[model samples]
Each structure stands twice: as C-alpha cells, then as structure tokens.
Target chain A: MSLQIPDDRTPDGKPESEQPQWRRDFPIDWPEDNYISRRDFTRFLVLTSFAFAVGQTWILAMGSMGRGEDRQGRELVASVDDIPEGGAKTFTIKGTKEPFLLVRMSENTFVAYGQKCTHLSCPLIPQPEMGRLYCPCHEGAFDLQTGHPMMGPPRRPLPRVRLEISGNKVYATGVEDHRL
Target chain B: MPVPEHLEFFIDPNRCIGCQACVQACAECDTHRGYSMIQLDYIARSESPQTVPIVCMHCESPTCAEVCPADAVKRTEDGVVQSARKPRCIACNNCVLACPFGVPKMETPMELMMKCDMCYDRTSVGKKPMCASVCPSQALFYGARDQIERQRPRSRPIHRFLFGRQIIVTKVHLMVPFESPVAPMDVIAAFRETVIGHVFGPNFSAETMVGGGK
Candidate 1:
C-alpha cells in the first residue's frame, strides 16, 4: 500500500513566511545588540545588581577586617626633656611611616601634628618670623596655636597627633586625624 | 562692530592696593550652588604698580564666546558670559590666552575653563559685588556701564586721556611698522608716536612739560 503525503502538518508547525515579526528586528551584522526582551533584561539587571552588591560587600568586609579596636603596638619615641617648651620634634605613629610633628606647647603640656599641609601635602615648616607653620611648596601657612589656615593656599588644617609624656620620656600614642 | 554700551572695567592703578580681599569675599558670597567667582594672582614687578584683582567686565565682543567649540559659554541678555555646563574643554588655552585681561583660569580636578560671572546673584539682590563689598579702601564699584562714564570726568581724567590717546595711536602705529624688525612693535610705536605728536608741532614751545622743559 502507497503512503500519501499528509495534507496537514504536525502540531505546532507553522510556515516560515507566516512566522511572527518579533524576531525580524534582531538581525545579524547589527553593530550593538542593545535591544532585549523584558524578561531577559530584568534577569540581566538583577545579575548586575547582585554583582555590584557583592563588590560593595567585599569592600566593606575588607575595610572592617583591616581596622581593629584596642591597638597594642606602642613604642618609645623620644626623651621628653629633649623637646623644649614651644619647640617641636618629628616622629612616626600608627600605620604611617612618615614623620609627624610633636610640639611642646608648655612645660608640662604637649601637642602634635601630622606636619603635612592638606592643600598639597607639603611638609609644614615652623616659621618663627610669622609664628605659624609654613609650607614652602605653596606658601600655605597654618596657625601654630590653633592649626587653622592663617594665609597662603591651604584649605584644610594639619592632622593632629596624640602624645603622652611620662617623666623624662616621650611616647607617640596615636593620631587625632582632624580633617577639614 | 557696534558695541552694546561699550562695556569695559576701568581699573585705576594708583588706587589699587592688591590686598586680595576680593578673592576671599568672592569665595564666600559667590561660591555657592556649585559655582565660584574667579580668583586671580597679584603679580607686580618692582617698578610696576601693585596688582589688582579682576573679574569679567563682560566685553561687548567676548573672545571666549567666539572661540568656544561646544558653544558652552553663553551671554545673557544683560551681557554676562557664563558657562552653561561642564565643558569637555580641550584645554587648548585659546580663551585664556585670547583674553586681554587674563580673566579665565584653569580649574583643577577637571582642568576645565573658568572665569568670573559678574556676581549676577548679588547684583540682582540690590547688593554690590562681593569683591567691591570686601574692599577696605573702597576701590571697587559696580553699576550700569553708563554710570562709570559719568564718573570718569570727575574721578579719572588722566586715565581717560591716556586710554583715549592709546586707543587712537595704537591703530596708526600698527600701520607704520611693516617689516623693519628693528625693535618690538610696542616700543617703536610708543616712542615714535610720543616724539612725533608732542615734539614737532605748532605751539611746541608751549608744551615744555612734554620733554621735562618745565
């Protein structure tokens, strides 16, 4: 017996010419395929958000892991008697390898600064003529008394440091990190 | 070209003290809403008079407006040049160098073009410019361009005479010096113009003060 070709096609079969126009716009050789279906785009956006969230979370985790309370790395800096009243000395404290300023304001009182001008991070030198801390780089001057901008180009104050003196010795405890 | 009221800022060299109080005051009052009035340096040589602070006088024909590739610098109806948005300025320094008054400054962190805006906000509120307000010596003033004209006769006669003479002679001097290359154009022009105008004229004896005769 001869089997004749079926007049009706299989189920869900449609002719190529009768196919919907949805896929026609997405042709090959297009420069950038920016167009995407709503479902596909939503999924992609969700994935991008997840990636950003992961990156932010990783940064936060690294930051939290780096800083710890109760720092115990204390060291002897200099002799307290070596620093005269209204005089300053240089020392490093707390994670920074750069030197900082330690000024003995009075006989028993002491103050310290990072010795860097905030405008250009230039080394601040003491100007006895003007009675201010001067930056030779941009002529930025900060008040010796208050660490505020007295003249020149500095926009922020020098970062202050914390110090402790016991008997005839000096110790650099930590930094105040005063930002302006 | 016909100028709109011939806008120009007349600076008196003898009066200015170069305190830079204008710079600080401008920073305080005009520096808000993401804008800052321009600040300038005070560079005075030994013989020169003290340097004075400057702002945009809103020229009748702004060189900045002509050279802007993006058309970002715009002049308001009241004749003030302002930057509409953060320009993708090529850092060409064309406007900076083209300006005769040297008002345009290159801002950092972006290296975009910057200049004065004439304190439009403060002026609108019936207050003087921040620079004028902060001037301790009362050296600065702002008003209609015509107001300065009326005040010039009484306040600044020598300046007006020199400025007018310079305006007239500069054009004539530009023509005489073609390709000699003996000296610079400015010096030769100034010397020739001064000597020729005053030295050999009718009633030249009456002008004894021209050559220290008086």
Candidate 2:
C-alpha cells in the first residue's frame, strides 16, 4: 500500500500493481438496517456474550503459552538532537504501521506517545507551545506530560510509548496501554 | 452562524449509483482524517440493489442532540450539527441509536460518537464537502437552491420528515419528485407498511394494522 497507514475500510491496494478495478470498493461486513426478529436479536446478544467468554479464554491460553516472550523489541526512533525542545518527530515501530510522536521537553526530559488520537483516531498534532497534543477532527486535546485528556471529547488518555535513551539515540521499548 | 447563507446540502437518493464514491472521498476529506461520515445503505438487498447515501440531516431539532445526556452534541447558530464533544461525550451510544438516519457511529476504539458535521471545517470556510464534490452522479449536492433547481428541474427539495406523530424539520434537504403540495415524509407509516407486508405478505391492508379490522 502506498499509504503507510490504512483507511477505515480495507484498501484494495491493487492500483500499484496495475490490476483491474473491482466494481465494489467498500464492502460492509455487517448488515445495516436489515430486519431481525426478536428471537434473532436475543440470539445475537447471547452469541456476543459467548464470544466475549471465548475471547477471555483464548487470551488466558495465549498468556500461558506466550509467557516470557519479548513481544516489543527495542527499535531505534531518533536521537536527542534530532527533535528540538518543544517539538516532536514522528516514527513507526517494527511490525506495526501506526505512527508515534516523540516530543523533547528539554535537553534531558523526553516523552513519546502513539500518534493516533484517543478519540476517532485522527492523527494527533503536537502542540508543544500549548503543552498539549491536539486532534483537529473533534478538537480533542491531551496533556504533553501525562497523555491524559485535557480538553474535548476524548475520554481516555493517549497511550504512552515507553522510551529508553542510550548514548545520543532514543529507542521505543513498548506502548504502555492506559486505555480503560 | 457557522454555515454561510445561500449554501445548502441536498441528497437525491435516486441518483445514487451505489458506487460509494461519496464514502471514499469523505474519508479523504481533510477534516475527518480517514473516517467517512456518510453511511451507504441498501433499501432492500433481497428485492433490489437500490442504495442511499445518508449524511447528517442537521435537523432543526436534532434527535441526536436531544437524546444526548452529556450534552455533547451541539448545533451551531448556522444549523450545522457537530460531532459529539470530546470531554463532554460519555460514549453512552444514545446519539447512535437516536439518530433517525442512522448517521452517528460509535467508534469502539475511541469511545466517541461521530457523524457528518457537513464538513463544518470546510463548509464554514465556504468549501463543498469532499463527498459532494466527488459524487459522479451528483446524488449528493452542495450548492444554492437556485442552482440545484436549474440542474434538476423535476426534483423538489424537502427538509421536513414525519416520524410517528413528531415532525422534524432539518437543515439539509432531500431532493424528491416535484409535486404541488410536498408533504413531510411519513417514515413510520412507510416502515410499518414494509414490515407488515413482509410478515403478512402482499394482501395486507393499512386499516387492519390500525384496528379497523377490514
């Protein structure tokens, strides 16, 4: 795909190869406005509940089997001097297409966060002068220091990306998922 | 007034080719990032392939805003109904369920209710929405009433809709067949007829549903 980031729907990703244009680009998986009987609605709810239970069981099994696995390997992001104080640089980690923002607070203090906003996932624009990250889509904002939402519709804090500085280089360790 | 005067949005379901160009262009709109606010719906998949593009009607009295417990949804003086406010929206999914057009969507990841704001960012600056701009069929139009009438002479724009006993007047207009006296569409009655017809087959009568026992 030309875009490092994919859109909401699945990208055809075919034009690059000069493939024939398929008639339908947007294919909705779920039914919209389709009629459902009372029995069907009840069955849907029951199935959803069972699916959640199965998901929990699967997670438990995966946790047991994947214990001690280093899922997030250290990936070099940028150097301290690369980003000026009160400015941010964007980068992506290995095996993930999502981007992250690394903002330099001072010569010593630096923080990183996932670029996607907590609300609606519009790419968050770093407003270092204002000491916050701003989402233009809904005017959502997050604190620069803690990633907690300071203003707008976003209810949860931006996921903080763990950073490790060694020598002149900064490395992204893993994302500290604080979404609750 | 956020939305400037003389400019309006029109939806003519008849012209929709089911190509989803509106949906594609909407996601590409600078305001929404990659999210498309327009919903493409089929009238009935079993019978025909007729499709409708549903944008926020931006009602005079928005049901989505009325049902919002957190007061997240806001309508400007210009009559543009905005997406739910971030800090204020509780993600209760009230707007999603309450919207007659099924416009507002609850993003599970973001826990926010988002819908078409008529591209308020663009529209406030006097630009057409991305969807309307790219529609090959002109099914979705954003322009003056005079221009639309000249182009689609047989089509009349209606902003009023009836749901059961309630009448909703919207900012956005739906281009319908031109008639002498355009009545507000009775969505509930039409829905009742469709549902009853499916259950009782073709021979069902409207009077029977109202306890006339014909």
Candidate 3:
C-alpha cells in the first residue's frame, strides 16, 4: 500500500493532500488510529443504524403515551484503542438529543457521561490536559473522575451512561433520561 | 538544490470550520483586485457541512503554466505561482481544466484567468497571505516548518500528493496523521474509497459484516 505514495517531492515543495471526506462529518480519528478492520467498519454501520431505528420506535411509542420511556439497549461507541488513557471521545446516541463523552481513566476503567452542562444543557468540552471537562458557555467545569460539577453555574452532577466492554469494542449500554 | 521559501501557507482540512473568513479576507486583499482567488469546497453538502479551502499548490512543474497556450501564467523565483498576466492571457480556460488541484478560475467578466498568488504583495514584504491571516480556526496557517510542527504534534504536514501516478509537489503543506505514509498520498484512490468502497463491501466473500466475527 505504501508503494502508491513516494517521498520524491524533495525539490519542488508539495502541497497538502485533502482530508478524507467522512472526516468532516464524523470528526473521529482515522480507522488506523482505532485499529479498525473491515469487519469493524461494517459493525459500526449496522449498529449505528440499529440504534437509530430503535430510537425512532421509542419516540413514536412515547409520543402517544403520558409517561416517559426509557431508551434501553447497547450501542457501540468506539474501540478500545480509539483514545489514549485520560483522553475522551464524544458521541451521540440514536433517538436522543444530548451528546455523551467517554473518558478512559486507566487501562481497564472507562467512564462515560452526558457532555451537556447541567445549568444550560450546553455541550461540555473535555479538556483532559486540564483534568476537567469545561463548558465555554458559562465557565462550567466537571471533574474527570466523578462527573461532579466542580465550579460555575451547573447545580447537578453530569448523568452517567452505563458502559460495557466486550473484546476490544466499547458499548454504551443505557442512558439516563436527560444527562447520560 | 533548495526550493523557494514561500512555505508558510499550511492547511489542516480537519481544523476548517467552513467560516469562509478566508474567502472574505482574500477578496479584500489589495492585490486580488477585489476578486477572491480562494475557493471553499464542500465534500458532501446535503450529508455533511464540512468544507475545505482551495488555493494554488504552486507545483514545481505547474501544469497550469505548461498547458497555457498563451504562456501568460508565471512562477515567481520565491515559488509563488501568479495568475495569468493581462497582456498574455487569452482566457482560453485550458489552465482551468489542466490544474490537478483545481485552483485556477476563469474570471468571466474580466476575460482572464486568476488563482491564488499567495498574496505576493504582503508575503514579499514579510507578511502572511490574506487567507492565512484571517482564517479563524487557523485552517490556513502560515508559519515556518518548526512553528507548524510545534502547533500540531499529533499530525504531520505533507506536501507531496499522488494524483494517479503523477506526483504533484506544491509549495504548501497539508497536515495529516503522523503515521501517514511518506509516499505522496494517492488522491484518486482515497476518493474512490470514500465514494465506493465505503458503501459496498468490496471483499464480501469471507469477512463478517457486523460484531467481531461470525
């Protein structure tokens, strides 16, 4: 595969190659970064579609009823190698509105929670370099370990999403009604 | 031998937020004569709002210059590929079709060919080009090699691109992941993968489509 690309641009100064098109929409690391095989790509698509289908059905079911409905089931969020320890990746569940962020704390422990600030439901940016998730909207911040509100206008702790790891794939099992 | 030093124009397509500040700023440059030389391209507009800015790659052997029948386009000593000059350009549109990077544009109203000149007026005076100057996300950053490397640690800047077998080297660089191949990236192959291979599993005989394995 490397044979296609040669480094012979030593004299004329070559311009940059365009980024992959999917990168613009997905905004995730390359398949190489995730160490994804062809099988994994298929799983990603199927699981994503399945999650979306289930979410749609849930919405239609709840629209006719008075009580709330629980968004149940597992969705593949990422592979284990997608992010290094202490780093985080944000993803959206099918049939849900809020985004969720997953943090890899150590070798075996990965924690996920809603990315929204409790104060205004603004998406919080994970700044692992600063050891806390920060919301630029109101200077709201949450601790990496506990998802507890550390400072600013947020009064409630960020909701946690239950996670299960199988093989090298990571799955988001269930989300709380609002936060997760 | 060392090439020209107008190496400051760097693009990180991933970092581009499609603000078009660069587009607005480029048209504002005094040298461009109120016409923006930069173009913003959307990958899949209906499906995605991602965009990347296009500027002259300033190829070492510029196809735009080679194919110009009137011989109007010129490459500066410092590696800037200037737009077709007024006296020589016939507005034939040959350069428009020949450029692999699709940087050149025909100004229909002016009856002339024009493209990014890296804002020679500002750069010659030791300043950044208009696009690089106003890019809000630093998608079009202008700096020395060391400066860019310091800013993007996880990514590597690449200047060589393989449009089929023709290796087109340019004055500017695109930042890609560090593990990317040293060989000029195969632009066409990547395009094919994005369009076809992703939609239909090419090797469907033995591979599992979902979960880990069958």
| Top lDDT model | 2
Query: All models, DockQ values?
Result: 0.00, 0.01, 0.01
Highest-scoring model, TM-score: 2
TM-score of chain A of each: 0.54, 0.61, 0.57
For candidate 1, write residues A1-180 as lDDT tens digits.
Answer: 000111111112244345355322321111222345457789999999999999999988885764423334446777877877677788876565766887776788766676888787888887544567889998788887777888888877776555677778877676555552
The pairs that clash in candidate 3 are A5-B183, A5-B184, A6-B183, A6-B184, A13-B170, A14-B159, A14-B169, A14-B170, A15-B170, A16-B174
User: Judged by lDDT against the true structure, how good is candidate 3?
Assistant: 0.76
In candidate 3 the C-alpha lDDT for residue B129 amounts to 89
Residue-wise C-alpha lDDT for candidate 2, range B30-49, written one tens digit per residue? 76757888889877656777
- On residues A1-180, what C-alpha lDDT tens digit does candidate 3 reach at each position? 111232332223332234444322321111222334457789999999999999999987775563234567989999999989888898888887768999888888898888878898788888876778899999989987788889999877887788999999999888654332
Query: Native-contact fraction for each model?
Result: 0.00, 0.00, 0.00
Off by over 4 Å in 2: A1-180, B180-182, B195-214
Off by over 4 Å in 3: A1-180, B1-7, B190-214
Task: Give per-model TM-scores.
Answer: 0.36, 0.49, 0.48
- Candidate 1, B1-214: lDDT as tens digits: 1113333334443456777777778777643334455454344344454565566645434556545554445555444565433634566667776554557765655656767765667655556667777777645655444665465444531110122122111100111122334322232233234233233433346557666562
Tell me the whole-model lDDT of each prediction, alpha carbons only: 0.55, 0.77, 0.76
Give the CAPRI rating of model 2: incorrect
